[model samples]
Target: MNPLSRIRNFSIIAHIDHGKSTLADCLIQTCGAISEREMTQQVMDTMDIEKERGITIKAQSVRLSYQYQNETYILNLIDTPGHVDFSYEVSRSLASCEGALLVVDASQGVEAQTIANVYIALENNLEILPVLNKIDLPAANPERVIEEIEQTIGLECNQPLCVSAKTRLGIRELLERIIMQVPPPKGDPNAPTKALIYDSWFDNYLGALALVRVKEGAIKKGQRILVMGSNKNHEVLGLLYPHPIKQQQTEEIACGEIGIVILGLKSVTDIAVGDTMTDFKNPTKEAISGFEPAKPFVFAGIYPIETDKFEDLRDALDKLKLNDSSLTYEPETSIALGFGFRIGFLGLLHMEVIKERLEREFDLSLIATAPTVVYRITQTDGSTINIQNPSELPPEQKIAKIEEPYVKATIIVPSEFLGNIITLLNHRRGIQEKMEYLHETRVLLEYLIPTNEIVMDFYDKLKSCTKGYASFDYEPYEYREGDLVKLDVRVAGEIVDALSIIVPKSKSYDRGKELVVAMKEIIPRQLFEVAIQASIGNKIIARETVKSMGKNVTAKCYGGDITRKRKLLEKQKEGKKRMKSIGKVNLPQEAFLAVLKID
Candidate 1:
């Protein structure tokens, strides 16, 4: 094995569909980490959903051996997702590296996420090597992209390494540059053992496996280690180097190396990401600093389609949470939806991925309610509480004010779509913060938008209006006071907790009307009329009726006495009124999803 100075730890960062994963494939192949026959596109993306969508969901790490300047050098590469929802994964990957390959699509130039990821890499103090990918395309404009990267992001990149991941062009030079430019890891091998847990997952055979980057000393097989955060001691049963094809087992993971530590533990919660692992006998003095836990920005209710599958859903979530620490959930029961859970996610995409995984991996059918943002409610008594579910909202008279989460959004688009983009932002109640032209053809816009505005279909609307040419990214800014009201949806005069939402007071009427109208189209008609009403506190804002399935009792009276027929009709009307008063409305899965299309 090479010394610490010969090992280079780096990650590839870029915007969505910018070829980050493809570039990783090129690197892995060039270093011969796996045989040519075993090579496949996007080898880092092991999940079926990831492969189907062509996106990296979880951050993946692999160790490769390369011969650079007559010496075998170890390269630890972490491939990170580019979507804004997966930014947490990118940040975690960046923490375990010393450098990053800023992969920018040659034709797309600088985008919103490109700048956002650069700031993260800069914060980690990683040496950034700008690389222009997909340069073989006919639309590839390397010179223009280079200029945009310098002007928009202000990176010192007059001469960036241009490469085409598809054609394997300029790949060798990339590897050489990584070895020369990226500095070696710095830590003492003789000091007490210290390793940072960047990622972890549960395995049926080995239990929970933690992928860590050793900072000091060494972690050996059968070594007792203490988790600094949990303050628990566990023995390291094995060590292995990460590879795309298969992990290679080893006896010891030395200092300044990246490897997986097997603790043979069944519970994944026992090991947390960002926790420090050290020798139990000679432990490190301090835990790693600047470690912030992942915070979920969107909340929604996830209920099993079959009421009996609630336990299966819970178990699935527990296993999923082991793979993704950002996901959170708690037992929540709804009068309308029965037993379920309120799950928290980083964004809408995260929510969708989780829902799909539960159905596909755990084989549990689920119905996910419309996504909503958290609101801080201040009562008349001067006490404050944060609530994510609309059903948990206090009464209007009891609440003094409500504050919603806000985000600083960055959008990069062509100059021609500026008007459409601005109009869309204005419609969503956004406040313009800044505007600058990256070049004559590209414009950058920044806005302060309420998180609730973009929780549902805002991204879809933006993409549609801009003709799919816009790149967007956002970060949590602050909580601001807003005129917000909880809009409740009622079926048969009974409130449905899963169908409620916290909307702005100004648009409450329109939103409520649209919601009830949408619900009316999905709710199945019963023997009696089903009243679909949207209300604010005690006041009804909008109402729609799913008319009863008509069955005439008068039809049974064939050409008999007119008085007898009238009496039969009157009795039928009385029965209908009584049925409406005692009947229950069954809401389909689409009724809960209707809230997303209310806008």
Candidate 2:
């Protein structure tokens, strides 16, 4: 086992497309961790969905051995996601590291997520190392970027490492700098075994595997370990160092090292993320603290397109939960969409990724309802409850007040689009907090906005207004009392619970109208007229109708008495009335998506 002084545990943090994963690939190649023939681009992103989306959803860890001065030093590199949706993943990665490489694009000086990650790293007390990536590009401006980082983020930039990850420039020097600049992990090897499980996943052959950082002591093969979170003890069946190509099996994971622990359990639920694992016989004094669980920001109902696929959907979610602990779901039946599950996600991107995975991985066609934020409701009896779906909202007369989640959003855009962006934010009920000019061309704006306002199309709008130049990031701030009411959509005079949403009272009229109009274009015309109405507690606020298909019954009675033609038309009307009473509208999948499309 290597001593604490020879080990460096660090992570890569940056905004999306700033080249975190690519730099990781270069580092892995530089250290000879994987053969050139076996190496692939972004090898750390294992999931097909991640590779297809070109984003990192889960934080990945690899142990690299670097030889310098005739001595081998072990560098545990944790590559984290750059998107705001996966900031929780970054936070978890930071908690397990002593230092972080803050990668900023040489062209795009400082973005929103770069600032957000710096704050997270600072909170974790990680030594921040500034690196200017993509220096080979034509737009590269190292001197300007260096000045911006120092001025905007206030990070030291006296001697920033400038390199192009794609071209492999200055990679060897960057590796050397890591050894010289980053501090070694501090821990006692003689203390009792104490490890923090930052990540865990279900393996087909290995059952449940936990990727952990040994904080205080050693974890050995065949040793009994206690999971402090669940208060359960299990025997360690195997130990392996995490690698992109292949995990190297080890007899022990010593202090100041990271490795995977294999417990012969059939399900991932047997263990939990952020749990403290220690020696069963010689337990630690306290469990690892300061590990906050991932809190879901958006909630939506996902149902299988086919009713019989309900069980299949359940099975798929069960397997998926093994990999993603941030995902939460519970069985719920919708009157309009039938049996489904109400799932919670960190953000819209997370929702989209999970939905895509369910379809691509499990071969299940699914429909997701409009996403909503959790609302804290106070009842007339002085009781309070938190709800994600509008269907779960209590009766209007029984409620006292409602509080909606708010977020502190950071947006960085070019100066030319600042006015348009500010106008857009104001429309979403955003209150300006601070605005600054990072330089002559770029502007950074901070605002407090309702979480629900940005849940659907706010990001898209921001991108359009800025001509795709805005970088946005947000974190949950607090819940504030909001004047909100639940808006219910009715098709053919029957409430469609899955299409319901909670919106601000001031915007309810416009939202209701917009919802009905959007639904009118999607709901197919039936044999009888279908009434689409939006209402708040039985008071109809907006209504639209899909005209019935015209059938000329009177044409059959040509040249007969006018009364005879009239009699035939009357009979047709009666038939239409009867059909309207019993006929059900088959809501297309787009009908569910329409709720998301409404502004």
Candidate 3:
């Protein structure tokens, strides 16, 4: 094959809603990869959640052929997730690309995430081709955005391409630019077998499917290969490209090419991101440039509403883990919710995506406990255990010392909300680290706070305080000793173990009071009076009481007014029958969520 005719691998990257997906669709359409009628908005956003949320959650790949100056070039485009939660995934996607099309929203200019994406791309040594998108929008200002990109990102965007993806304007030119700028993969086809695992997922029928980008040599079907990182050997069953209709089996997948390998491996974890694939007979000691596994900072318990479907939940989680390597789960027994899994996630979005996938794909109703961070606790015997659940804490006497995870949080918000944001952070036991100005209107505030303080509803609270104009980014700093207390929630005099949390004293009152009120509204009126209390050890910080109900009348009437009163009594009796007799009131799923949300 002609080296110039070979495929050029690249990926589109940008902040959320910055037209990365839109540009991908335009590129595919302009390159005639898909039919014009099939050109849907955000075509790469195949997941329902991704489409609904107007953001790409999963990375998708597509193949396009562009005729640049009569030379046909294979353009392999990888679309990556834009959210900060999937930074690790983004990094993996970037590894597969030799170049990156940095799509910047002409109107919005450069966002914090854009900067992050550009930095990652540069770190990967990817040739950056900055493209300004959404040029048709009313607020589009390509020139100003290009200037900002140059100033902030320190890139020379001398003539950044301005294109309206919606109008199909300058799209062809952009494709031509990609062909000219991005270099074809450079690898020795005659060298020892070497490939990079850019992404992998499990297939129900074929087992583990790895999206491998061959960097050197050739990978052939029926060849025994070793997953360099795991030292595991597997036989390749087949190969596939982006063409959905057909599975193409070639004699060999040469250098600079992207294809899927059906390695009859039973487990998805065998082929990790950035792992090198080599022929088992001749292996190399060098490891691929793969990223470390993303550490999950937030932990939560997931339970099914129907106890009998616990196995279904487990199966669902198994399937989810195949696709999302970041989600970690282990069996846990809850005093209130029975057997479930204590799952760890990178962040709140990761947690929600897993839960949503479980419910949507498996059709199971789930109840999740409030998220908690891992706490390092030292026992009197000097043994340390990481406690993710408050209920796992040992007795006060047994605990010699406890340290909670802390993060250095950087929040960029409008200047007007600086005072309010600071006050809220202080309430959460956040100590001021530094405060700087991003621009005249934006303030960059940094704080070192306990991870547990910001794990639950803290993001929501921060957004609420900043009026949705703030962006928060955090990295784990270290675990530090803190003045923390366990806040136990009680309903009908029985403690709800799932509702308990360990929080700093400064924010305990507000958190406890808010949660108690939320529980009171959602716990339903039982036959007996229910008291909702938030207590720290022996002290009660807040309390709310749900009054018990009176007996329902169901007797018949004979006369006119007596008949009406009797009818009303009968209705009351029916209503009481509908109410769940948990000592007396009816509780629904909504109530459960309400209690969890403290709304």
Candidate 4:
């Protein structure tokens, strides 16, 4: 067994744009992990979309070597996403680390996402140290932000380190604090070779790469190990530390260290995050605790723009899901959308990321239906069905009751906008659970809201209502009986399953009308009239018509006698009638996409 005493494993957590990636780059540069000449901005944010959006989309691991007090220490850093949607990434990263740096913006102070992440780190028993970032800014106030963190997140701000991540100011001292305060990992190196699989992703050739924290023993190349959660045994094909730019090959990753295990398993399910790995022959009796799989909270339908490219879309999704385990999908077909897949995600941002990645990476244009939540339907025969796609919902007559998922949400906003936020939440059917005033300026509002209510454009609305000063976080709660009905949109008297949504009974009429009006503008006008109708069961709530395109039938009757003009007009009317009776309204890809961005 190899003893590693001078090793530190930690994650840098903060709200978006609070210098998480910048701080990570400084650490890497200072540790000389990568040459200064090669250092690029936001090196940890390797994804092109992440660079463009100015946010970290995925959790990235970087290994560094630091020398302090004449001793070389190994530092393993996992840079996690700051958005609440990606909090699951932070949780899994926390399981692999011994401590975390709770970074708060000196200018903006602590936010909702930071508080949510702090609780997750606490649950993992990770030592958390405070770091006030961006102190070089003119409006920076570390003292006020420290007080806010203590008041809102319940974390002591004693001796909080202030650093300007952009200028590399106080970063050396921050690293010193990490070594002095963050405790060394505690585990038995000689006991049955145990490790925790914190994260995994797929590679084109190497297959699944499991990023692991060696808890009790060393993992070397050619070592046979078993992933307890997946119950699959495979040999470690390669061993390397996770680098930002490239994989740094290592002879072995000993206990108290973090590294990647190349299992070469083709399937993502074969290597589950939070699963435990142990030596095949000397397996441990119990797998690690706190290894629950992340469940999808929001679901939507994804279809290719072209009907003939359905197989291309399916193949792309299969390849994408091989790397994105959080993304779940199944086959689905629609009368209007042709063939596609019903995909589930952690949040709206997750759904967007998946779509963007699919398009940018695979070059496949697609249309995603309006997002929906899983509905639990109890039938008259005492049977239960879980509907992921609204089109799959059972008939209202067969459903004895429908249970809709709810979420316990936390929202933080400036006190001045409290009234506006309250009104907004009320309109969304959110029930106030609790409220607290933090630091006399910001208010923390907790609400119990329907999961389906907030997934669509709630975040965008919340940000707009509060002038981008509000933050929201939520978790799934128990489902309750809801007055829910499936709202269907009919195009030219044909039900378009792609535009169906499960909405509250009370809002069905308004929502149905909204859908009808929105689709009316999206569907193109043809030579024959087309009716866009929105309905609930057999009742029509709203109807609109895409007016027929006019043709100059009379223009053909040139030296027009009154009888000739009349004959041409009558012939045109008959032609329109025949077209309306036989012509099918084939909605284009834009029609299905319109529902996602519609008000």
Candidate 5:
């Protein structure tokens, strides 16, 4: 086992697009973990979706050996996702670290996501080391950004190491600060094994793989360990030091070290994130805390293009869920959309990335319904239910009141666009709580807004209103009581549950009308006239009709009497009416996506 003084565990955190992956590459190169020719751009981002999106979707852990002053030190660096959608991932990564390198963009300074994550690190009671990145850019302003970080985050402003991850400038100095400033991990190696399972996944051949930070005692190969949360005991098949691309086998992983444990279990649910691993014969008195399973904030229905591929999609999801615990799904059936799964996500981008992976990695074409937040419905019998899909909402006669999720949103934008941003938030039923000027040009605004109001296109609208210069961050604030009503869309007199949504009572009529209009545009005209209606209860708020593809049935009776032609046309109308009664609406994929973009 390595001595406590020679081991350091920390994570690198930042806002989205803050060059976290780039900085990680520089660190890996300096440590000589991988050769310069072998290293790729964003080497930690092994997933194709992450590389395409230019974002980190998962937290990666790597052990590096650095020699300084003739002393060898072990550095365990846990790289975390920076997007707001994966903030929970950041929290889990921080739980396993002793400190964090708070990377700030030298050109952009502190952003909405950066401030949110810093608070999380502070809550973990870890030391914060601020590092200014992107100093090689022509527009880089290190001094101004450091000042902004101090003023915005209230951190002591002084000389922070300035480095260019792209050019590898000032990297050696930064590495020196890491050893000099970041504290080594502290734990008792003599104690019983109480390792924190911050991350876990499934391997096709290895069964369940868990990544843990050993808090106390040691775990050796072939040792029996118990998962505290699941109460499942498995003999450790192997222990591994997690390298970025390749893993190294080890005999025993002692306390204060990060390692992976192989458990020969098939099910992913058998292993839980945040659960502790302890000796089977002698267990720890207490399990690790502060790691909660990520609760999904966005919900949508995903259906395969072909019903025969349902099993394939399920298998793919099972495999994906092995790696992603934030993703939650269950069997769901829709009258309009048929059988599907109702999946939950942390945010919009998270949902997008998951869908993309399913299609790209799993080779399946899937359709996702409009996203909705979980709503609490109080029934007349005094029972409450938390519902994700709008179609799951109770009937009006049974519902006493409806409550929707809300978030405390923080927005950073130019002062010139403050008025426009305020108006947009007000329309979404936001109540302003605080507003402050960070600089002469930039302002920070905080507001309490309904989660449903912003899950769809709030960010896009905010950016559009500010000319793409605004940044946004939000977390689940509370479930507030509101007069929420379900708006159901009916095509050809059949309610399409997949397109249903819970909207504010005041704006239900307008929203219902807008959806009807949008559906009318996306749904192609059929052989029979289709009636598109948006309704709440028995009240029809809006209506549109897709005229049938007309055919000249009367043309067959050319040169016949006008009355004879009229009689033929009347017969055709009767046939069309009968077809409309039995005809089903086969909505295209575009129709499902259009509903999500409604204002």
Candidate 6:
């Protein structure tokens, strides 16, 4: 194939609010992939949560045709999620691309996620094209940003494109750079089929639709192919590019081409991200490397507010798993929440997205349990067990030792808030690793802290302490030997074991106190007095009491008001339906979430 004819595959990557999706929309519109009148802002962000949250939660792809100097070229555009929590997803997106458009905010310069993304691009050996975005902002400093990019990324940019996606400035020049700098895909068109599954999703009518970049050989619809990773054969039923579906009778998909194939598979388990597909009859050694499945760091129990919607919740989770393979779930029975599923997620963002989708897409009312981290337990026999639920934790006698995961956190804050942020981190048992100046107005502080300490409301606390100017990024670090104790919550002196968690001793006092206070506000006043206590091995560290109240009744009732009294009782019954009865205390859904946070 001609070098120029080889299609160039690339994606736009940046931190949240850095204009990745906006740039995609502008590029697609300019390429005539979508009409200007029909164009929508952040077109790649198709999910409802993505729109409401103003962030891309899932990666999306589109194909475009760009003409530069009378040469028409095919550009496969992959839009990647910007959050660090979805770093695994971002890696899968990058695997499909040969080059990447690194968009950085001109005024904000470089962020933690921006640096992380640049490192990933470099690791993948992708040709990086630095583009300074938000150039129209009042604080725009393109020259300084270019210097920072070159110094930090160690890449020489010859006249880096400066553009405002909002204003459509310098977009044409960026397109020209893409054609000049990014090399087109190259592979043998006549070799046996070899393709990489960049992304896969379940289609209601078509089953599994895999977004693939044909790295080598040709593939045709109706051809029997085997996914080399699973060694399962599948028949391609349909083929599609970015637009309308085309007949599969054509010769075959050549190398360096991006397209979709319906593998007529029932479940998405057969085809996974980073897996390779090839012809079964004549197998090649060109199988694509697979990234390890992202382990869910947080676990929560999801229950239906309406008990009758139990099956509905299950179906919703099943559908969600089709799109997000990172989400894991299993049936769980809670004494307080009849029947539910213990759901696991990559991080808090992943959990939030799942919950939002269940509520919005499935239109189901849900009650979620407090999120917990998986604990590693060492038995008396020296065998290790990983426990996700407190109920699954071994009895105190059988466990020899236990360890919780830790994280190396990097927080960037304004100079003015450095003292406040440092104090907050210290309270959370964070040991200062280092602190350095990022710029005149900003500082980067590093700390080694337990994952459990920061998993709950840590982001919110950081924002509040920093006046919403601090940004944080964390990666899992090695666990260290520390004092670990199980903090349990008790109501009316009866231990609620489900609420118990293994926390570091250094953080137990403050965390316990905060939880008890929040629970007091959440747990409503009951007919019987209830005492809420946070304890460790029979030792109470914090306590709050809920005073008992008399029966709620009207002081006066007249003959005409008899009907009103009946209506009042009916409303009371309706309210009681929403509350979960634990002994004599009635707990609302908010109480569970309140206990999950530190403040």
Write down the TM-score for model 1: 0.98
Candidate 1 ranges beyond 4 A from true positions: none
**Candidate achieving the largest lDDT:** 2
Query: What ranking of all candidate models by lDDT puts the best one first?
Result: 2, 1, 5, 4, 6, 3
Candidates 3 and 5 compared: the better one by TM-score is: 5
Tens-digit lDDT track of model 1 for 207-265: 99999999999999999999988899999999999997799999999999999999999
The global C-alpha lDDT for each of the candidates, from Candidate 1 onward, is 0.91, 0.92, 0.80, 0.87, 0.88, 0.81
N/CA/C clash count, model 3: 5
Worst 10 residues of 3 by lDDT: 579-588
**Candidate 2, residue 13: lDDT:** 94
Candidate 4 at residue 396, lDDT?
Answer: 76
Q: Which stretches of candidate 2 lie over 4 Å from their true place?
A: none
Residue 564, model 2: Cα distance from true site in angstroms: 2.1
Superposition-based RMSD of candidate 6 using all C-alpha atoms, in angstroms: 5.9
Q: Ten consecutive residues with minimal summed lDDT in candidate 6?
A: 242-251
Candidate 6: clashing residue pairs, number? 0
- Model 2 Cα displacement at 507 (Å)? 1.1
Total clashing pairs in model 1 = 0
Candidate RMSDs in Å, in order, are 1.3, 1.2, 5.2, 1.7, 1.6, 5.9
lDDT of model number 2: 0.92
- Where does candidate 6 clash, by residue pair? none
TM-score against truth, every candidate: 0.98, 0.98, 0.88, 0.96, 0.97, 0.90
> Against the hidden true structure, what lDDT does model 5 obtain?
0.88
| Error in Å for residue 93 of model 4 | 0.8
